[model samples]
Target: MSSKMEKFSVLMSVYHSDNPHYLDVALHSIYDDQLVKPDQIIIVADGELLQTQNDIIGKFISHCPNGIAELLQLPYNVGLAAALNTGLEHCRNNLVARMDSDDISSPDRFQKQITFMSTHTEIDVCGSYIDEIDPVTETFISTRKVPLTHNEIIVFARKRSPFSHPSVVFRKNKVISVGGYPPFRKSQDFALWSKMIVNDAKFANISDVLLRMRTGNDMMARRGISHLKYEIKVLGYQRKIGFITTGQFIHVLAIRTFFRILPGNFKKVVYKIIRKCYG
Candidate 1:
């Protein structure tokens, strides 16, 4: 089915800390280059953005075809998970394509994902490989590949998140029925995927790069001790919810904690090596 016949909404969230210029590029990537454009783009402002950020979004909305962009503003910074939940609620379509505020979706990102979902009706959630890029220059640093089948995804989820969050297009109702993103600051995507797996949702990957994800020191910094605490909490919840066994949960928790404390520079190097091996 064409995208127009099988409609989907693009859901995104932004906050004060997000770069306005990157946001502009992200919006254009979605609105401009696509075989099939989104029926509606829902952007949830997690909190009050800077005047410049507001202006960037306002200008995009103004130029959008009528009723294409739906902007929802929150009174405070409620973090990504909560903000995304709000955006999900406002989505008018069953299939919602996830996008990050600063990441650029490939021109065929939506087209590919929607086409896959349309054919593989059993796949409740699907994503694709991504090109990790330098946030400032947008230079492709490396590719991140994910498992392509449901069983592989389930096993991979036991060790790491199987899908690139922003590269995914999932069923809104399936996600919501599993309680949506948990109220965590980081690893919210991992948490949600865990819940969905426990709920027996089918998963897959397209095996083609669909998004250019921006990465920088800021992202590595977010992997510090505090974030590790929340990740452990998420892992424990996963174990409790039976998505993972006690042994698998403990093993992953230990490895993740060790990496969390590594120097940001070293962690970046380690990440590159891993991506190369998996790429």
Candidate 2:
């Protein structure tokens, strides 16, 4: 399918604490470096941003084609889930690609995803593998791959996320039909995927790396008590929805909680082992 015939929107949320430089690079990758540029780039400013951040956004906007970049500034920070839900409301296109403020997308990311989605009309959501890079050095760290078929995705979702949240392009209406993203501080994507799965929304993942995700000690540090709480909440929802059996929930929760409590360094090692085992 020609990208020109299937116009799509790029959706992203940025907050005060995000790195300005990273955000600039992310926007550039999805626009200047992309083979198929989005028809519209909708960025939700979750809260007040620094002057530097605003300046970077201004630079990006100035370089974009007229009406291609849209910035929605919120009066206050509403976190990721709420911010994304707000952004989704403004997405004029049926297909919306999700991008993180810190990730660098491959030049052909949008082209590949749009082509796959256009051909696979039944699949409402599509994601792909990601190459994890060091935040400081910008060197390759690992490749996080997800299941590539609907059945495999459903089975994988019972234990872990079936798709990389930042690497996904999904049908906007399908996501909204499931109540959009739940208002959670963390693991919102996990909950959203579970809801979509139970609601019979089809899913798939391209068997190729489409984005380079930044991961480092700071990322590992986030897997603490708060993250564990949200993880359990998502697991409980899965159990209630019958997406996962009680035994499966308990088993997965036990393992996740153990890893969550580990020191940042130890958690990093555990992450590598888990990825290697599953990759």
Candidate 3:
């Protein structure tokens, strides 16, 4: 690890569904990148991965220096939130960079994020925009952009997720102090962000894209009646934590309900409009 990034760990959670080959690509993108290399890569195995997945992880660990890649295995399949919470407890540094098992980080990602966190000591969490890509061919499909300032992020989080989950690097102590990621089935990150905001944690995101995220075709399948239920539940939690008012919670629920009933194509348009309006 380089001196510039010696204080951070890359935290990722993997499970059975994640593609082994994609995981290989993702790990290489982090380990074989630019001037700053992470001091530790803390990968939490959410559940039992396939033999192939285990082999892929072994291959990567063989190349890393001893103790650089730490794998925390769980006996059963825990959801993302719980898995991440466990990973957080094992992190060796205060600054932890969040990574998805299948997303590719840009060569300058660590350098950019580390520099930003070092200079802006008050910012507890920092994220960046990402390019959505077709996983098989790795072709860019679109971009997911977020607000770059603290106030904008707070406003945007009222309606949608303000930070890309896989592109964020945050202070471990701050996150842990706020109770870490809540154990929500679907909107865990959003829920955690809401809690962090209520705790007065400063947030920021770079305007430039710093990661390539693989989009599953069935990603939209996760957003229907069930997803709306989860969102409403998250909204309720946010209100309970005093992050949002009752009126704001009701307004968000109505908008989300309307979007849930719309056809897939129309929902895409509505989401695009929302992103552009918030962006």
Full-model lDDT for every candidate: 0.89, 0.91, 0.88
lDDT of 1: 0.89
What TM-score would you give candidate 2 relative to the actual structure? 0.95
Q: Supply candidate 3's per-residue lDDT for 234.
A: 90
What are the per-residue Cα lDDT tens digits for candidate 3 across 173-208? 999999999989888999999999988899999988
TM-score of each: 0.95, 0.95, 0.94
Q: Candidates 1 and 2: which is better by lDDT? A: 2
Q: Write the candidate numbers in order of decreasing TM-score.
A: 2, 1, 3
RMSD of each: 1.9, 1.7, 2.4
Predicted candidate 1 versus true structure: per-residue lDDT over 34-88, tens digit per residue: 7789999999999899999999899989988999997899999999999999999
TM-score, prediction 1 = 0.95
Tens digit per residue, CA lDDT, model 2, 1-279: 333447899999999899998999999999999998899999999999999999999889999999999899999999999999999999999999999999999999999999888877888999999998998678998898899999999988888998889999999999999899987788899899999998999999999999999985468766698778888888888898778899999899999889888988888787888887885
Total clashing pairs in model 3: 0
Score residue 161 of candidate 1 by CA lDDT: 90
